[model samples]
Target: MNYAPENSESAAAAVSAIRQMIETGKLPADGRLPTERELAAELGCGRRTVRRVLDTLEAEGLIWRKQGKGTFAGQPPDPTGALAAEIAPDADPLVVMEARVCIEPALAELCALRATGEDVQRLRKLAQRASHPMDADTAELWDGALHRAIARIAGNRVMLTAFALLDEVRMGADWQEQRHRARTPETMALYETQHRKIVDAIERRDGAAAFDAMRAHLEALSDNLRTSIRTLDE
Candidate 1:
């Protein structure tokens, strides 16, 4: 509420404020802004000052006002929509499962071939931490880490880095939170048992067995996605 711009801010702070709002994604492009009066109140400026600022913004091509409809950001900040956009209901969980099916079983096979003491130890640590006895929900963090650990054990930097992309997708779409909503105690127990089985196979250095176990995990996950989608369709 301190309308005083720091000395670093140039004389035309209002216009700068508007640009900052757009840049930081507080005001999404194609989204309407508040009324001039409301903006004035928030900015601690007079309505006339707000009008002057709006005129300057229009002149600079930073924004366009539609009279009664308010203003819109001239340039869409992020085409990727990291901070905006809805999760489309039809976005396929199958695609994620498909990637896991293709990527993870091979990852396990490589781990079986390439695992050093450090690699196996890291995988075991991740699995243990995720499956810590306190709460199963806490296991979900380790769940993601376990996959990344497997990829790391594969010794492929490119494959390991896919975890970052998947993490970004999960954040943007809120994947784990959404999936958690669909889970029951029976389901949680089922997944925990399956996860431990895969880890055990990897620890046993059974490459083919580990691969099969990993594939089965993805198959089950895909089935769950299918069932969930059917319920949604219903």
Candidate 2:
């Protein structure tokens, strides 16, 4: 069916159509989707738009891609075993952020206690990349990766799973839009400073300091998001 979505509405409508198909079982579990070219043709949109929709769906765990195989419908591997199964797919972004505030500080503390020398170095590199991100999207991408790397350093499977699920929700289009709207060069610089502090605390093996730094960073991020939301509303 040629959808022919309007120019302004195309991206969102394309995503919605694919999601509805998946939800209604028109696209069965493990079912492979058409190629990007085919989807663009079928939806009457550009290949770039379809690709973005696919990227978003894949990030949200609604689909998975195999190398040279194709994109298929379903959840990816559960790193936390069955524990990750408890995470709701449609979790609210605010709630996800609140959960991150509760969880990430402790993870940062644990990372301080457990991080190997190499792990610390890896974090330093990630932080440096995030600090000088080429764009808002790149900044968010590296920002998420930096946090996930800290979680990995913490070396706890259950917590890792929780972090992964939260990261997935954070990658949703809505959260991405909110973050993009909230970000400014000034705010990014502030975040870079905060990120540096967190890494510094972790590298020094100061668990308490790491915890506090992470908490402060998240709290500042929450405030920034709120201000942005208000600005967008106005």
Badly placed stretches (over 4 Å) of model 2 are 1-90
* Candidate 2, 1-234: lDDT as tens digits: 334444647889999988987788876455878888888888878877887899999999998888898888887655544443455455655677788899999999999999989999999999999989888888888998999999999999989877876776666436678878888888888999999999999999999999999999998888888888788889
lDDT on C-alpha atoms for all candidate structures:
0.69, 0.85
lDDT of 1 by residue, 1-234 (tens): 334443323326766776787667786546666677887777766666677787887788777776566788774344235322333333445666676788889888877777877777787777677655455466666777888778778888777666445444554564664466556566666767777777777777888988998888778767776777678778
Candidate 2, pairs of clashing residues: none
| Candidate number of the best TM-score | 2
* Count of backbone collisions in candidate 1: 0
Which window of ten consecutive residues has the lowest lDDT sum in model 1? 82-91
What's model 2's TM-score?
Answer: 0.64
Give each model a TM-score.
0.56, 0.64
lDDT of 2: 0.85
Per lDDT, the best of the predicted structures is 2
